[model samples]
Target: MAKSLLFIPDISGFTKFVQTTEVAHSQHVIAELLEVLIEANTEELQLAEVEGDALFFYREGELLSQEKLLAQIENMFTAFTGHLKLLEKNRICPCKACATAPKLELKIVAHCGDIEFLEVQGNRKPFGKQVIEAHRLLKNSVESDNYVLISKELSSDIELPIYYYSKVFRFKQGKDTYDQKEVEYIYSIIDSNKLNISEYSKAKEVVFDKPPGIVFDRNFAIPAESLLEYITNLSYRHLWVHGVDKFEYTENEVTRLGSEHICVINNKHLNFVAVKKKVKPGKYVYGEMTRSIPIADTLYQFYTISPISENSCSLKIELYWETKSILKKLLITLFAKKVLMKNTKTGLDLLFKLTEDSRSIPSSK
Candidate 1:
């Protein structure tokens, strides 16, 4: 039983923020906040889960000291508020101004509690009342300026100062009213360098952890929508050939290139593996090639991939029914893919050189 402690910050009414503005209007603000969250999580925390409005952070079981929790929440609040100010200065959202917008004030609640980690079906499942109660304390608190609250259960467990706020209110809960008591915290400026997760999410830096499988998502730098018009009239097929006949694809039928077959070849602990799909216009697909490998259930094809770069992309070649009986299992395993690691790098290295100016798609005549 490995003991545990966690911090969960629930940004109030998150669904309304993104939904309130138009896609064109909210794009920059949303991007900025996302950047801040990613930056903060990458810089400060070990980075757990990023749900819609809530975030979960996990620390080493032994490192759950009161001082650390205070520092974590303080830094997060600092970053969150600072970014909020930047958004206000740019007139991103009139409602996010803390002085003027009461509804947009962020509520942060922190706590430490006991938990036992167990291995269930070869998966780690950590459960306890600590997290549930702490979550309740957060939801129970009213929104205020840096209004952070903690429960007595948490205050008793960890050594920290608690600002008492006894003015209690009742919240509607399925026709029942419940106690909404809270204990606040006095936060200071967050020192970014002291954060534990800051190094993991550098925008330009790539970290190699010998990933569970390969991930090839180059479309971030080169999109398929832009490339569609370029390939529309071209009759040439790009063949990602491997373990096949050569004269079968002849010159007039295709423009062949040597590219990496491994767009994204990684495994999730050798249990859950995924491949990203990049769908192009006029490309043939018997199935959704957006993020799928056709007929990949039972047999594993050793991937041959082209070198990946920032602005290059790969193509998806068609899969055939040559071995029908053996491919049944692959069909079943195709739907649960979590990441879409496309095979563009393989295409870039094999077909055309991706120069700096080669990023744009050709316009249709």
Candidate 2:
């Protein structure tokens, strides 16, 4: 029988990341990275399972050529690190989970051997001693969290050298014993700077020559980070902001600069894009812009949260609008401004009530 391939790409430091950071945001970050890795699968490798922080994959009755295997590893690594860079550059949340997400790393393990199969709950999966060995290889002495490890059997089958050296990879032989059986492998510590990471959209920082037309300031008894999450997370939009029929956004995605959402009000769609502007130090700011309002050519709303104490913060909401039509300006000044100010005050009142109620409940963490 021909030998089959076993592959696993594990997120290094995941346990520590989850344990040391905010749980909800950490989960979202890990989920996003896993999705990125899955999208980077160019070889059509069959996914067997998602083992918590790792993905179990297999290619039956075949081992990829040395070039193809190396390319696959590099592709996943590049995608993973590219996303980390994107998170770092576009982050808006001040929570520890979002702030430290760039520190996460990835490691992949590859092995080849004769395979067997097992059926569990109508799902067929790879089974046998080779599968165990492949998982065991993940615990080897690789000395680095970011690396690619190929078993001796796989290296021999693919004709990969023992001492391979490249700009991105510097491979060396290593061995470790599991169950009193010695297992040999070659690992290369990946240099993130050496990989050609794909580009991502940077945050769009806007500048306005004129001051905001309307501004409202309020104090909240919640941390700045918590208040920012309540404002930026679209899930909490309809609860506090009234008159919105529905909010449309990616449910599982973390809100970051350049993220977009649609607000359905009175059957009209208002498209908004997350944006940013310069703010003072020690302040967390989130801004959104839209041109979908009929009365104005452009509208921008910014929420700046400044920490007053460990458990208290001040929120300032600024509204800016522009229009070239004299009639539109007249409408904004006479009718639109009053309506917007009313809505803003109502929303802040509702948010403050919600935060007060939340404080009574004990934290799950």
Task: Give the alpha-carbon lDDT of every model.
Answer: 0.39, 0.91
lDDT of 2 by residue, 1-365 (tens): 99999999999999999999888888889989999999999999999999989999999999999999999999999999999999999999877888899999999999999989999899999999999999989998778999999999999999999998888888899999999999999999999999998678997799999999999999988888788888888887887998999999977678999899999999999999999999999999999999999999999999999999988999999999989999999999899999999999999899888888886322211
Leading candidate by lDDT: 2
Lowest lDDT 10-mer window, candidate 2? 356-365
Show the lowest summed lDDT stretch of 10 residues, model 1: 251-260
Q: Encode model 1's per-residue lDDT on 1-365: one tens digit a residue.
A: 34455666666545565576333223334444445555655335444556556666655464356655555555565566665543333221122221232234455555556765566676554457766665666544343433555554455567444432222211111111235533333322223233333222111211223332333322324543333223321221134222222212211111111111222224311121112222234332111112234434322221222223434444333321222444444543463232112333444343344322565643222
Give candidate 2's whole-model lDDT.
Answer: 0.91
Q: Give candidate 2's TM-score.
A: 0.95
